[model samples]
Target: MLFIQRFVEFAHAFPEAPAIVDASSELSYGELYKQAQRLVEVIESTSSGSMIGVLMEKSVDYITSVLAIHLSGRTVVSLDRNYPVERLRQMVTSIDLSLCLLNEQEYDELNVMLDQGIRSLRIDKPTAPSADNDSVEIKPETLEEIPAYVVFTSGTTGQPKPVMVPYRSLSTLIDWMLKAPGRAGTTLLYAAQGFDVSFQEIYSALCYGDRLLVITDEQKKDMHELTREMVSAAVTRLFLPTSMLIPFVTFNLHDSQVLDDLQEVICAGEQLKINPVVRQWFKAHPQCQLINHYGPAETHVVMEHRLSSEPEDWPDLPPIGKITQASTAFLLDDHLQPVLQGNIGQLYIAGRSLALGYYGMSAQTAEKFVTHPQTYERMYNTGDICVLNEQALFEYKGRRDRQYKIRGYRVELKEIEIVVADSELVEDCLVVARQFGRTTTLVLYFTAQDRDQDLSMRLHTHLTTRLPDYMLPSFYKKISAIPLTPNGKVDLQKLPEVGGLRSLISTSYVEPHGELETTVCELAACCFGLDRLGANDNFMDVGANSITLISLLAELRYVLAYDFRQTDLFEYPTPRLLCATYQRSLDTTQQGAPTVVPASSRKQRLIAIQRFQEKKGG
Candidate 1:
């Protein structure tokens, strides 16, 4: 059944049951249904095209708008509320966006940012409650082919490709999700609104009669607050991207019982690496299951591997597991023929779970989604390279294209290179994605026309206008010329190491004064790949992101033996400010009772202090 149809049934069966809960409010199934019905009436009367854009911030109302559009037989094109206005404009213009659904706040904030004369409607709950409980149902056969929504992914051609997903695709994935073990109880909706995973979190919960807890962006950033919210809400199922999962477990799950109700955790969006921290986390919470899911935007979730065994036995790189029952996956070579069982091959998926194809890019779509020669079934050629293991399960090797997942968002390096090359600031450029301390970051190496000292800063400012934050390179390197091989292709191996380059920030270096400042600076330098860092160097300017900040927090707690909060890093991003904040915390703790540093931490501090003194002597 379609998730919308199932949601309607759930509402009628349990009207008073809680459906959505956020920080400020809770909406029962009955209230949610009533609001959606009212919104549906408004949507149907708007005379908009088939594609309806949802531009509201992540909230219950935003979800209501999505459901209303589906009920009105329109496709939802979610405009990420946090996306830059320039990027948002590209999405709106690319599709036949006839109407945008927004709340009062977004309507005011984004009115001028969006295209002029674009029609929009404000989402407000009706003063009079709706008495109708009528359900909008489409026949199964027809619904399978109808477009439900469009998800925008990075395109190799310097634009975001809209993947048109039909109702059957999502229904197939959600059906498998509901039947999955330990997926019951309250599920946290932590994914960004624009991503397809949010659909899984929403439909899998409400459609299956599980409570959906919507965490705010602020809470999602702060590890301490996120943990408190999870414990308080008793979230049983968590869907975290692999990038966030690493630091979350490393820093937050030390207390085995912090999230006593967490029974299942699913990680996707990036390759899962079972590091030591993750192993220790699972060892502490033996009852919680860790699942690794793998798929592209073209197919929601084609394969998943669940680990319920002891953490000690888990592989460092777990297999993506057998294909889900909803879809069939094949390992094919360059000839599109099935590869031998043990050989690495590209994965091709074909089944009810396949999407309709890319919107407005038929050629690109045909290139990706092709018909099998013998079977004649439509299959999506996933650029993922994989090999079958001893158990005949698919093990992810790497990507065949220049695409990379940064903080769970798929980015095509070619797209960024095209933008940078067009900036007129550089004669030629190449962008590469690299894994730095468990975090994936983009690094751009370019040869500029003028080679001015401020070219890196100028290029950085130019890219921000055209690309989103995730697509921007974390570090910029000014090379004399682009490295090329005999075939005239960019040679990635020739690029210099980003760590050995001069500081990207132009701030003058200031040596640390005291022991606390020196220790903090050393840890900060270690977190970011810098040999030496000034006290005033901004973390943001040095490629410090939320993931790195979490890693730094874990390092700080371990080395300082102080319970450093996530908010402290945000409030004081620089090394000097952070050290000052730490000193204040220490002073407060000392006035009442001295907080003893651990013996191990004392030894580490002694080492850091000794290193600082030696540098001074030199």
Candidate 2:
């Protein structure tokens, strides 16, 4: 059966079920179904084969309008509400939007300056239906020219790349993977609607006999609130960014009782990296299924799937796991020769999961998505570096481009965090890189501050065993808190920004004086890849990130024989501050240099140290 028919069937079967709920507003399945058809009538009333833009959040209106566009025999382009006006305008102009699903607020904000005309929809009382279903006459066309939706992604070249998806693969995904179970219905947790992954996830979830829990971005961002809802609603099936699961589990998600009926936690896009905290938690709850998936937006669903039990073979390795049964994977070096088993290379996926091609980008579409070298069929150059092991599983390495490279080394930021998280000292940590023109540095940030001396020593002792020497960061700047973006991801931009000469010290940080402060500042400058070293500044507000902190810590310790812990760095965030503390300790010993240590009296020192330690422990 066709994909549209599948969507329509689910609507008919569960017309009375609740489809979408957020805040106080609630829309039943039947009510949403009619509202969607009303939008369809409004759409087909104008142009039969035109593309309509859905500029809404991940709510009932958004999900309903998607099928409405398909029902209207028109293409739909999912648009982000967070995008800047200029970028939104560019997308609207590019797609030649015939109709736009907008609230009254959006219409007031957008209608005046639109270059290409659009029919705005402010569904007054949203129940008011337009009596016109005669406009939609379904046409059968399997030609590659047909476009289901156009999704835009940020490309390396600083331009928006649209991946035009066809109904064939979209339908195949629903028919194959999105299955209905007896007595238990899946709740489709909607996230990333602007991205193609969410589009397919959402489409397939509702199309197959399932109850969709279409969520707003605001709900997902609130981990505590979202988990409460997830538990209350007994959400069995969920889709999310893999990066989120660990932290969400750490913060609010707990207990076997909260998710007793849950069978699958489907995750993708940053899923190859295994977080020890989440892994351990999942291990404790063996019955709850955890599915780690891999595939680009160009590919629908997943080309690869790793069940939780696959870890038996990966005691020393992290793998994205084996490709799906209907898909084929290739790991070829730069010269396109097949790499030896377990040798790293660029990944190329072929067979059913490969996308039709990028929309409006003929050259780019041809370059990356092309015919196989040996066969007549097509393949997509995944750009992700990986290795095909003897077990036939593809393990992810890192990105190939220089933008991903840091300090003349291929750094997998995720690997560093994974290892640190496994240490058990830190509840959570993140590594991020900042580049100032040609110079680059890594920063490491974690939730724990007062890691015991034993914890610090153990962390240092095991660095060589777990990570490669070059991959180890030079500086360690820790913060008591790690700021999160509105979407729950770490906000890298908020990290302290280092400047010339004084860039080594974290921005806004001030230190008690000693000769060691100067030396540590120099090391901080070098770790951050700054041409000049500074003596004063705080780290967090200055933009020193988690990855830079770890990278700098490794460089300083290996290069200089100082025994510093990743935990100590957080307590004393700036180079001047940490170095000053070290210098004072040496002076107290009355052995190293005879320099006068900066002192605010012994009583004040004790109080300061107590406060510092307290801040770090939390």
TM, every model? 0.92, 0.66
lDDT, model 1: 0.81
lDDT of 2 by residue, 182-251 (tens): 6546575656656666665665566655566765665665444566677777777777665445444434
User: Quick one: RMSD of model 2?
Assistant: 15.3
Tell me each candidate's RMSD, in Å, in order. Answer: 4.3, 15.3
Q: On a 0 to 1 TM-score scale, where does candidate 1 land against the true structure? A: 0.92
Q: Which candidate leads in lDDT?
A: 1
lDDT tens per residue, model 1, 1-618: 787888888898989988888877899998888888888777777756888888876788888888888777678888887777878888888887888888887877678777775788887634345447576554666666778889899998988898999998998888887644443489898888779998888888988788888877878877778888899989989999987776688666447788878988999998887755678788888779999998899998989899878898988778999899879999999999999989999999999899999889999999999999999999999899999988989998888789888988999998898888888888888888876545777899988767666588888888888787778888888999888899998888998878423254557888877766777777676556566677887878778877778777876765666778877777887888988877788787767533335556656644643453343221
Off by over 4 Å in 2: 25-29, 125-145, 253-256, 310-317, 335-340, 402-618
